[model samples]
Target: MAQNRDDDANDGSNGTSNRTSGIINSGRRGLMQGAGLGAALSLLGGVSGAGGLISTAQAAEAAFPQHKKWKIVFVNHVTTNPFFVPTQYGIQDACAMFGMDYQWTGSATSDAGEMVRAVNSAIAAKADAIAVPIVDPNAFDKPIQAALDAGIPVFAYNADAPRGKSNPRLAYIGQDLYLSGYQMGERIASLVDSGMVALFIATPGQLNIQPRLDGASDAIKKSGKKIDIQTVATGATVNEELSKIKSFYLGHQDLKGMFAVDAGSTQGVAQVMKESGLPSKGVHGGGFDLLPQTIQLIHEGFLDFTIDQQPYVQGFYTVMEAFVFLASGGLVGPANINTGLKFVTKDTVEPYLNTSTRYEGKTTKPQIVPMKGAIKS
Candidate 1:
């Protein structure tokens, strides 16, 4: 819901506000000296109060040029999913910094057609830029090209087209899905030497998560282990995912491990692992995202780990790319950005459990989170 706000009031603490204030104060002093408005505005072009000049490119790096407020439309596959809360916050924070606005629109379920329609709508409305998760390989290609044809930049976030596939989206800002999944599989192999494991997915074959499944399966196969992997398709909603996971566990009590790739499914695996007391039975469990419950379950030693895909940066960086492209009049090209993946185990999940901030979509209040010790990679 925070993403729905058309205009977010500045708290005057961000760099953008400070820079604008400094510019204004400098302008006032220049005006008092009869230097005129042009001389005052020249400060943005790297003119110092001491009369030193800097290159225009250097000035561009420090401050953006004056421009109209741009609007970005983010078309998502699951508009109301809890996993994307921090992602929307990222969009909001970046947009606020650049004085831009964004609209969060898409299907509540993982409906590629609905998401495609939303993309078309954004293009039709002449949005300054557009962002969307290319959940369907081909569904979004035409719409993205249409947006680009209209001189509007399009960026992909959360999900991307399959590798080596050409879609018109300028860049991708999200995790390296297959690599993350392969690494997860490696972790799974380390945990359970050889046994039955259940891998739950919210939606099967969706570009957003299918690659992870494929990668995990391939990794397990490549390991040449006796692990039996049963891939289950859990529904899109959290409750449905939980029920499906529970049902699968009920049917296969001999499962040695439980895991998932999506947020809701991962949380479901944690829940089922705890409810069934599977960890006590030597059942290893893990998945992805930073859902509060998943973090707690890991802290409690029920789930082995949850991969952190840094969802917030997915939205924030996508907006950053869009902003620079729009601000520079297409001179700055959009490039693929991997937000990154980190394993949040019990040993490393304390900060996640202790802190509640907009950065993690835990709370709406904005504040700098304090660092207490050495940062872990």
Candidate 2:
């Protein structure tokens, strides 16, 4: 008796056709069954003994097929900022790995209203998923809900809505902005002694940098030191930020230190300190991000330290969450992620200076570089 296809399906095995079936009456099939070792080897293209070709049905089931190519849209507050160069690379790498697509669009000047419009457009276009910075506390609330209502998943990255104010975005993937600033403030306290310290920011009330400014101010107040901290507003443009920093240095020659809460301002602080020879003047300075100039200045002792918030992973995990949600059909929920913050100073700036990779927003080519020494804490 010949076993049928239905019988093979119910057998709980590999679904190989049983030769005992009378339906396999062809002479070629009979010859393959008869010549045990040599014929089986030839049929299998190398294997010996009873091992031969699997049934067509079994082979089809064994193949691992590709998943649907889902598209994710990312809305940013600062669309052209260099700080997010690595973040874009992260999104690109993750999308390529998962066979997905992504779009980067947002306001160039951190306009909350513009970001809201982008969210609405994404919803209208029926995007698979969306990621946003949530830089405004109340601005994103309605738009995120609208996205959710449209059956599209949404996530937050780089920045998040304020605490105690509920925004409907799923998760955030960036540093604890306030905490990072508080810690930097403590460091500033140790370096400056009862003199004026200038804290520069590109945007004063913008959620992305405001919380950090608040944290730094709070930490300085908590220290109970006679430190006079002043917040200076640097314009959004890098050249404007640099000019402002230079002018500030010129006027506040007696200042004890300068620090910044944002990327462009941080680089400006480094440049001002270097040209003014502030370190030799016993004037300490530090700020956030690992801009190439910032790293070089830190190594040269022009600036004290700069924080690395792993911007690359912020984009990487945002896409990963979106992919999982689309693939698992909502069974896998997105979770908040904190991309780590690290202090890079003269002692630890070598690795950043030596490496030219996408992770650092340094280069476009992918590569693996050898480490020379044990990593420092």
Candidate 3:
């Protein structure tokens, strides 16, 4: 599959908007009609499992069987990320526990074209359910439509399509990216003084992380601090990210804060900030997800905060939802599932240190810390 490599840095573009465009074949246009108005919904009853997100499926009246064997496809953005290790574990574990067959595949990066192909391949294999990270609003319209049209239940997990984009991806099973951004910005506000802030992202306008960048931008702007915001893109490589952060800082040494919207760039941002001898103020830093490195940076006092979108829940629930909906008669919309959000900081990172979080590294079972009240919101 061809890839679209765009610099996601907010240097020229504020990344406050999703500016991606691609043509959805006319035949598939109608599939993009499903959207929401934040209507009055009350599915609070009969909710079971983590975060009250299991289900109230039409099969709510019928007792759910303990064993179900269905095939599910999980299309992720960064398939190799350790942040996804637990997510994958969650999906695989849930599939085993629920008696479902699951396959995990996605591009190494947030390439919408690659993800669309993965979804199509899953459909071609006649998957019973599909879970995707709707990273590109324009790019995913057709494939998402195709899945739904094939009588397959598709759910958007982790990153969602831009709000009101008319993508037909059944329901969203991930964090409220923008709200997490707002919370990240709030934490940054507490750490940085009045000055310029650098917003680092992997690929702007891709799908999942852009909403978070936009959210954080809005919140930081709302803070009434004389903060000049600059967006910088880190091409999808760890060394590239480290170099980019170093370059941005070398060029603009006065930047007061650095906000990274992805995990890889978060660590880079912190490393560069530390090497530049910038305090948490002169270059206050915050980011998304908790990789071991990002957490280590936070402990070493290089990063002010990083949002935890509960990636494990994303992995666990995406499978659970797909499994339940496949067995049930209909879809599991807001009427059923909800992916949660949590912005983690120094005050909150301790509890997570020992919790069964989604940041399981290779060859390491997630360690649990039997404590609470460390990270701030």
Candidate 4:
């Protein structure tokens, strides 16, 4: 597994320039190896059984040349958040597969200034590529452009700049944040007829989540229901989010529903719902992410349904995109990827509660999970 480098003055460079000559040379070497083996195998009329399988695998490997262990820098808005544990695991798995390395560094408190500095650090380090969550619309534009100007491919993951806004990142790999929120809002409207409903957000204007909040509010407003939506700002940390959620519920005991746009606040919503026994009182609660506690609460009937944005794929696909761009020496164009959104209800939460795997950031041990039933779409 590749180790995650922290923010430090010493860049990970060991006398390597940002040149594609090494990659091209490696490709030529692989091509020679493939040509020699392919001609020999053809003369021998190929092998059979296990020998044939090994030969095929070797040929496939030869097709994709292995170059220098490229390093990609991932600048996140919340570096230590549990929601990204699986995301990091995805980064690790992808890096291992692609023979690459990555550094995970960013602000622990969603500080845009701090995140910008991290991006600057990565650019200065002469990283092979860079990925970041564009949490702040304008703050990342300059840094992304700078990275691109330095011959480093920059990608946006988890969050992207607002639509119609220009940002120089190559691609975005994450769920459709605004659409997911609108869909969740529709769910909320369906669950609650009319009353005061609270929506909590970790940060009010952050691009990563603010669109979700905006979408939810718009959906609720369009529902034409008498529901009163109150937007609450919960601090970045989990403990602070929990406290604020609890306090909100205490003051709005008569609220019809409670939901959140982010992971931590969603977990906090579930906790409050359970502690206050709000579900038994016909109060619906739900939010996003697959935090262990969130899954458990959903299974326990405390939360109606929590949305899954496939955080693991967000990291995995971003790395894959970066790898292709680097391996191709800028020939392969990276395209935007929507990770996807799925609502996890009580019926669908069983698997999540039963399994503890790196896919969900539950365990570090890697193993293929057995499937016993028909797959859900």
Q: Which of the numbered candidates is closest to the native, going by highest lDDT?
A: 4
Candidate 4 stretches with Cα past 4 Å from truth are: 1-62
Tens digits of per-residue lDDT for model 4 on 84-169? Answer: 87787787666655556778888888999999999999999899999999998899989899999999999999999998899999
- Residues 227-294, candidate 3, lDDT per residue (tens digit)? 78898888776778788888888898877887798878887887876777677345577787777667
Q: Rank the candidates by lDDT, best first.
A: 4, 1, 2, 3
TM values, all candidates:
0.85, 0.82, 0.77, 0.86
Model 1 lDDT, residue 282, Cα: 93
Can you give the lDDT of residue 22 in candidate 3? 19
- In model 4, pairs of residues that clash are none
For every candidate structure, what is the RMSD over all alpha carbons to the true structure, in angstroms? Answer: 7.6, 16.6, 11.1, 6.7
| Candidate 1 segments whose C-alpha is farther than 4 A from its true place | 1-62
Count clashing pairs, candidate 2. Answer: 2
What C-alpha lDDT, on a 0 to 100 scale, does residue 93 get in candidate 4?
67
Best by TM-score: 4
Please give, for residues 1-377, the per-residue lDDT of candidate 1 as tens digits: 01121122223222111212221221111110124235535555444534665432333334544566677888888776777777777877776655567788888888888888888888888989988998888888898998999998999998999999999889999999999999999889888889899999989988889999988888988899999999999988888888899999999999899999998999999998888899889999999998888999999999999999988889888877887777667877688998998999999999999987878877767677788999799
Give the lowest summed-lDDT range of ten residues in model 4.
Answer: 9-18
